[model samples]
Target: MAHLLHIDSSPRGDRSHSRRLTREFVEAWQQTHPADTVTYRDVGRQPVPHVDEPWIVAAYAPPEQRTPELWEAIRVSDQLIDELIAADILVIGLPMYNFSVPSTFKAYLDQIVRVGRTFAIDPEDAEDPYKPLLLGKKMFVITARGSSGFGPGERYGHMNHQDPYLRVAFGFIGITDITFVHVENDEHSSESLAASIAAAQAQVAQLVAA
Candidate 1:
């Protein structure tokens, strides 16, 4: 059975749309795939440490050349990477803040996106030096936004950074098969928010069945 990694990055507890949707998605997923296993991470409540100078040094250095101190510096990074590598599917509850991901989620991304682990550089191939290591994985992002119009050619499309940034970051590690479900209009009228939530929940249901 497939293994799923469920991650929630919304600081708001029960009030967060993203968190609620992700929980619903996972519960539905488990119902269908009874044998499947799930691993959960809550970066919003317990944020991962941001990468520091020692982390940089440790990441860049070859495994054989790294000292005990260097290994210690990247211990948490290694654990995060291990969890990512072990999972076949990922479901992230992301809330947009100022048109981008929250700082805590960004920190989680920084911890897992590592060279020689998630990706590699090949000096021999000048045309394609960057190589993605993680493969055969799927990702589902449940994003909650304050307002709508983040789609392409929409009113605020030009100001949207969340989707593109996540695509590039996750694609860099070979997770190109990604799907996004958005719950928008949080700051708008209750009816608008309700409609968005209904659409998002429908999409989530479809995805789980697929």
Candidate 2:
């Protein structure tokens, strides 16, 4: 059975659409794959710290050359990377904060996307240097937005950075098989919100069944 990693990045508790959708998705997933295991991380509530000088220094240093102080600096990063590598499937609840990911989620990303852990640098290839270490993983993202029309060819599609940024970031780490389920228009209309929710739920159900 496949192991799943579920992470929520919305600060809101009960009022978060992405959070609710992720919970629903996980529940449905468990019903279908009872033998599978899940690991949960609430990055929104218990946000990880942003990368600093010490973290950068430790990350670039070789494992053998790193002192205890350096190792300690990257301890949380090591743990986060371990969880990412262990999971075969990932489900993330993401809320769009000013057209991008929340700072908390961004911090988590900075921690996990390490050089030797998540990716490797290749000096031989001048055109492409970064080699992805994590492979054979699938990811599902549930995104919530205050406004609508972020899809391709839409009015605000050019302004949409959340989905594209996520795709590129995760794909950089070898998670090319990523799908997004979006719930939008919570600020303007309730009917639109409900419709989006329904569509997202249906997509989640279909994905879980498959």
Candidate 3:
């Protein structure tokens, strides 16, 4: 059975669309694969610490050479990385804030995406210096936005950075098999919001079954 890492990064509680969708997805996933294990993290509620000077030093320094203070600095990072590496499937719930991800989610990303842990740097290789170590992983992102038309060839496509940025960042760690389920038009009419929620629920059901 696969181990799933479920993360929600929406500050809102009951009002968060992405949070609800991800919860439904995980519940359906469990029903489909009852033997699968899941680990949950709420980065929005309990934000991970952002990278600092000591964190930078600790991350770059070899594990064997790191001092106790350096090790202490990277303790959280190590735990986050270990959690990430243990998962075969990742489900992330993200709500677009100010046209991008929430700062809390970004902070969690900064904590987990570490060199020599999630990725490796090979300066000796002239052609390819940075190498991704996390491979054979699948990711599903459920995103919520206030507005609509953020898809490809849409009016807001040019202004959309949420999905593309996620792709690039997750791909950097060798997770290229990524799928996104977006619930938009949240700021629109009640009918539109209901329709969006229904559509997202249907999509989640289909994805989980598949």
Best by lDDT: 1
Those runs of model 3 whose alpha carbons end farther than 4 Å from true positions after fitting are none
Each model's backbone clash number: 0, 0, 0
Q: Whole-model lDDT for model 2 versus the true structure?
A: 0.94
Regarding lDDT, does 1 or 3 come out ahead? 1
The C-alpha stretches of model 1 lying farther than 4 A from their native spots are none
lDDT (10s digit) by residue, model 1, range 70-181:
9999999999999999999999999999999999999999999899999999999999999999999999999999999999999999999998899999999899999999
- What are the Cα lDDT values of the candidates? 0.96, 0.94, 0.93
TM-score of 1: 0.99
TM-score per prediction, in order, is 0.99, 0.98, 0.98
Q: Candidate 2's residue-wise lDDT over 10-72, tens digit each? A: 999999999999999999999999999999999999999899999999999999999999999
Which parts of model 2 have CA positions greater than 4 angstroms off?
none
Query: Model 2: what TM-score?
Result: 0.98
